[model samples]
Target chain A: MIQKILYNFKKYKFLLQQLVSRDFKVKYKRSVLGILWSLLYPILMMAVLAIVFTNVFKFSTPGVNYLVYLIIGLVIFNYFSEASNLAMSSIVSNFSLINKVYMPKYVFPLSKCLFVGINFLLTLIPLYVVIIVSGTELNIYHLLLPYVFICLFMFTLGMGLLLATISVFLRDMFYIYGIIQTMWLYLTPVMYDISMIPENFQTLFKLNPLYQFINFARSIILYKNIPTIGQWAGCGVSAVVVLIFGIYIFRKKQDKFIYYV
Target chain B: MKKETMIKINDVSMRFNLGIEKEFSLKQWFVNIFNPRKFKKEKQEFWALKNINFEIKTGEVIGFIGSNGAGKSTLLKIVAGVMKPTKGSIETYGNICPMIELGAGFDMQLTARENIYLNGAILGYSKDLLDSKFDEIIAFSELEEFLDVPVQNFSSGMIARLAFSIATIVDPEILIVDEILAVGDIAFQAKSEAKMMEMITGGTTVLYVSHSLEAIKKLCSKVVWLEKGNIKEIGNTKDICDKYENYTIKHMAGNYDI
Candidate 1:
């Protein structure tokens, strides 16, 4: 099964590229600022959150720049949230193609991943600039950023596929997903400090995949420290487990998707 | 000389659940799982196609004639490998290019030029191949001026023309077309018909479904007349089409005044 997917990947690589590219193009279409909004949107949100948290709420990060800290979490959280949202609609939105063509079903959800991944990668540019301008130190540990990205990507892909499949049968999945996403955002320490959580409860918070990824990412970019091997393993394991389960369910249910959609 | 079988369908059936109210969330599903009686009255199973069996030899131009809701599209979708049959199976040799719906894979926000690549990839054409055929597809569609404009701006007829051009660019071994030629302008329709004839003459097996009886008679060698999800008649085109015309006329005699 894996081999067949890889073979189809090679054969349909261009289709995937075009599908992902179309998403990026349509997202910025007719906007005056165009692709700049992908960067600026997160920066603006971070600024608002930074002010509200640091001044209004009296929250502060002693060593790390609060703006940088909030923005990293926003970018990562935004990608996962946006990617899953798109994936939920991916199958139904392309019902015309599904009704006519014989391409692999996973391509639809996977393309959503690629679309969000591109935006995530592009958003990193502004994050990098902020890190440099703020006098944050860069070290070899920053190379481990890609590993964190892979974890988040896999988790998103799996979650997206699962949602995409369910959404085909039940169109309300997206609305339900929207509420879950809002809940998930608050649960993750996107704007708040993780250390503020009681020490014993921190382990429960650490179990959130986004928490693991964001912590590992901030450790590299802001703290100039490599994540402990346990953190790396936690992210990798979470990604693999979610991805395998997603693919399994998606492949199992995809044929029925034609009728349900 | 004997022709080899290109497509084989054996006892294929498609069943759809009709009345089970869809649950939007796990909470609803869990609640309904205990009390399934709410939707029990509406619980119905409809067979879209029933025990369908057919075989097409290589180089055969077969036409599927059926009224709306007669499962013609369902059968073609099964042949295209997009939908799985509830019962039985189908086996086919060679790559299938299904123009089941014009511009099925097109992105409205992308230019016609960009859509060529997008649609071509959905049809399983490699990027390099699409690149090589890009100019040919554009020229055939006659949308040179609008190549840079997003397809959302194109008229439905223009989209159909573009779709037809891209689909016909390659000489597919098997082509499944379903009522697609009806959408474009008459001139492009005639031109696309000519291109289809050219493909047929080139020995490509074509499975076409259209409401136009004239087209079916002109193009098909063998015709399968389906009614209510079952094959009513399968024979030479002239014989079945004549029967179908007479049947419809006789059946609708007093229902409508001409």
Candidate 2:
């Protein structure tokens, strides 16, 4: 399977590059800010959430700056939601091409992940800006952030694949996922600290994969500490498990896609 | 010397489920799980292609002739590797260029120049190859001035011209053409037909599907006449075309059931 994947990657590398760039171009086409919006959007959202949570909601983290903490959670969770949402409809939207030519179907969803992944990386700029502006000390542990980003990316790609496949069969998945995403945002400690959750339910909340990912980022960025072995294990396992399951389900249903699409 | 076989279709069949509910939401699916009678009533099997078997030797130009709903497009798609057959398999040697639809991958929001690279990449052309052939494609397409304009602004004929130029830029071992020859204006149609003739004579194995008997007779040495998902006849182009013409004439006169 690895060999086949590698071969396909090499074979379709040009197409993949084109697809990612196309997504980037089409997204910002008419907007005056163009690519700059990716950098600015997160910062603006973080500011609004930071003001409301600190002033109105009275949320706080003991040692960490709330602005930095909020941005990290926002960036991570936003990537997951946005990437999965776009990738979910990737295959269905490209049925015109799928029906006429012979290219790997997975490229559609994979390219969506890559496009959003690039956007996620750009949002990291605003994240660091908030860190510096908020007077949070930068540490060498910050270099380890890529580890978390990779984990988040893998998890999102997997979810994207799963959702893309499901949405092909059930058109209602689009709206259903929107409601689930909103509920998920509230469940995750993005604006509020984890300490605010009740003790008994905190354990259940940690079981949410996004919770592990957001917490892993916080360890390296906000707390300026390397993630514990347990943190590493949690992030790695969830990412790999979801990705493997996604690939399995996607490959199984891909052949049938031509019929339905 | 005997030529090698470039393509072989072995008992390929395609079955489509003509279910009453073409699409189902998760809620509906869960609700219907307990309704066995409703589930049973929804399934209606449609065999688009039935036990299709054929082979094309190297450099052989084969034409597929059929009336509407005769599975010509399905068979073409299967041969192009866009769709898998239900019960059989197809083996083909060498690269295949399936011009099933012109500009199928063009993003109308993108400029023509951008689309050239995008569509070229989708067709498996490397950046270096597109760079080298970029001028040639534009020159052939006759849209050099309109390169910066978005494809959505272009007329259908311009899009077809651009697509044709990009698709025929490289000669592959196998070429699958499905009713794309009659594209653009009459002048452009003649030009594309000439280009196709050049490829056919240059030893590219071609599988062609067209309703135009004149085009089939002029290009294909052999023809496969399909009727309602079955091959009614397969032989020399002139012979098969003659029989197909008579069948269509008879059917039109209401002497035949369908």
Candidate 3:
């Protein structure tokens, strides 16, 4: 499987670049703010969530700034959701090219992930500005951001691939996924902290992939500490398992995707 | 001297499942899971292509002529590697430019200049290659003034011109065209025909599908006539065109003749 993916990557490298750029171009085309929307989305979500949780709910953490904490979780969660959502529809949306041309099926979903990945990274500029302006101390621990991000990216891609395959057979998956994401957001402790969860359920909550990823990010960015070895293992294991499952499901179903599309 | 085979098809067949009562909605799929007999699925099938066998020599210009739903496009798709046949296999050498769905790579919101690179990349051209050929592509398309304009604003003919320009930029080993010229204007058609003639002279193997019998007779050395997912005739262009024209006239008049 790895060999096949590597071979396809070598052959379709140009195609992948073009696809990712095309996504960026189409997304920003005719829009005045262009990529500013990427930063705006998370910031706006942070504002609303911060006001609600800090004021009405009166939620507080001992050491971390609530805004920084919420932004970190929201940005990471938004990346996962947006990337997977776009990738989910990648196959269905590219039916025109799929019906007429022959290329690797995975490139579609992978390109969407890369596209959203770029947007996610770009939005972090604003995220960092907020973090630094809030007088948070920078340290070497923050350098491990890529480690946490890679975990989130792989996990999103895995879900995206699975969703892309299933969406081909059932067109309703795009809408169904929206509902799932909303519920998933509430479950991931994005708006509320992990402290809100009862002691018995905390372990159960950690089982959620995004929960582990968010915790990883919070450890590095907010707490200025690296995640434990177990946390790293959990993130890596879930990512690889889902990615392998995704590739397996995609390869199994891809031959029939053209027919349904 | 022996001619090298560019494409080899041995007993290729395409089967399509059709007229099945599929659950188009999630709610329907769920309900049907409980009540399996509620919607009876009639499993009707169609043989889009049946036991197709052919070989094309390098530098040969071949034309596939048939009526609608005669499996002409299906055969092209198989050769282009767009769709897999249910039976048998096709072996093709070198790069193939499938001009069947021209402008399939274009994002309508993007400008023509951007789309040229995008479409060129899809056709397996590198970024540097596209960059170098950008001016040539624009000149061929004659859409220089509209370069900055998005494709959505362009007419269908303009889009076709752009697509044709990018596709024909590099002479491909195998060129698969399927009635794409039907969309563009007469001037662009004449220009494209001239370009195609140049490719033919340059030893590009061509597998073309078009309703224009005149073009096929003029350009193709060989012709394959298909009817109802089966090859009816394969011979020199003149003979097949003559027989196909007669067959069409007869079939139109309710006479079962070939």
Candidate 4:
């Protein structure tokens, strides 16, 4: 299994490049703005939401500017949304490749994690520049950015593999994910700060692992605070559990996948 | 001294249902779901392969010649481990480069050059092997000018040439090919056949499937003829193909081409 994993990782690198390149090409191939839309879309949305929510509704996350708050949330949430959304069809979309190789099936979702990981990093560069302009003076400990990325990386991987596996047996998974992702964006406090919720509502948000992840991320970027031991524990456990379950399902159902395809 | 048996298929059987029900009722889909694979496709259980037993010595080339639905492809799939058998054992000493379906793994969306690399890896060609043979594969396929274009735009002959070229790499101990030569024009077919002969001569065990009796007689030293999931005969290529052809003609006349 290890050799298979290693070999597939090597092979999947080339295909992953194809997938990301193809994705970028197809998305911007006809659009007038081209790759500029990658930066323009999110930043534009951030500007609009920052203006409207802060001035109009008077909404603000505790001790964090609305833009910083929104960027943190949007960055993390984009990873999940893009990862799962792409993952839902990753196996079926790469049917031509998957059916041919005798490699670990988890590579499909892992590759999605990689391509979206690149997108996530691209979005972050402009975000960091804004942080510099805002003069937040966050912390030297902001060097922990890499560690936080690692946490989010595993989280995306776990969810990607899980969704990819489920989408195989159930064709309705994509449609279901479509509705769920919309609700998920609102339910997780991406646009609004978690502190905006009523005191009684805090525990409900804690149930969402992604909610905890974003809180930790926002703390690092905005508050110059590293996540507490418990925060890390909760997110870590959730990530591991998803990975274990994802791999288990992937292995059990992999051979039979050809029949479904 | 114990001779090493490179490929072994012992009592392997593959069964498929015609998907017709005995009662011919609307609710059979639901009922069949409950029973699942236990129930045959039709009321009748049709065996694509049954009690198939064969052993190919190391470096031996065997041609499988049979009429349509003769279980030749089924046996190859079992040998290649592409599909599992109903109730039997199949084991191989080393890797199998399975071309059970000629264009099974080819992606039309990819360019010929890119598809060559992707298809090469899938067919068991290592990166090193592909790099060394890359130019040769392109030249042999004669897809040079159009190498960068997506294969979907390419003609059927181009697809077959690409698939066959990719499958030949990696020096797999066992090479399982279906009726891939039916593609392309006469010149290309001759080239492919010559390449296949080279592979056989180079000690790559070949399990070739073809409807061309002449090719079988010329190429294969040993032959296995299948009929309705059973091995009707196994011997020299010409003798078994003759028996197979005579049997096929007789069955066709009796059934009124049904």
Instruction: Identify the leading candidate in terms of TM-score.
Output: 2
Spell out the clash pairs found in candidate 3: none
TM-score of decoy 4: 0.84
Candidate 4 residue-wise lDDT, B214-249, digit = tens: 877877879998877888889887778888888879
Higher-ranked by TM-score: 3 or 4: 3
Clashing pairs in 1: none
Q: State the weakest 10-residue window (summed lDDT) of model 2 chain B.
A: B20-29
lDDT of each residue in A1-261, candidate 2, tens digit only: 889989888989889999999988898998999989988887788778888988988877898888778878888998899899999999999988888888998898889889989888888887788788889889998788788889888999999999999988888989999999999999999888888989999999998889999999999888878899989989999999999999999999999987776
Query: Which candidate number maximizes lDDT?
Result: 2
Angstrom error of the Cα, residue A251, model 4: value is: 0.6
Model 2, B140-173: lDDT tens per residue?
8889999999999999999999999999898789
Candidates 2 and 3 compared by DockQ, better number: 2
True contacts kept of each: 0.80, 0.79, 0.66, 0.10
Candidate 1 C-alpha lDDT tens digits along A90-199: 88988877877888988889999988898889888888887888788789888778999989999999999999888887777778888999999999999888888999
Docking quality level of the chain pair in candidate 4: acceptable
What's the TM-score, to 2 decimals, of chain B in model 1? 0.90
Estimate, for each residue in A80-146, the C-alpha lDDT of model 4 and write its tens digit: 8888788768888876655554544565677678777877888887788778777777687777667
* Residue A128 alpha-carbon offset, candidate 3, angstroms: 1.9
Q: Which 10-residue span in candidate 4 chain B carries the lowest summed lDDT?
A: B17-26
Worst 10 residues of 2 chain A by lDDT: A39-48
Interface RMSD of each: 2.1, 1.5, 1.8, 5.9
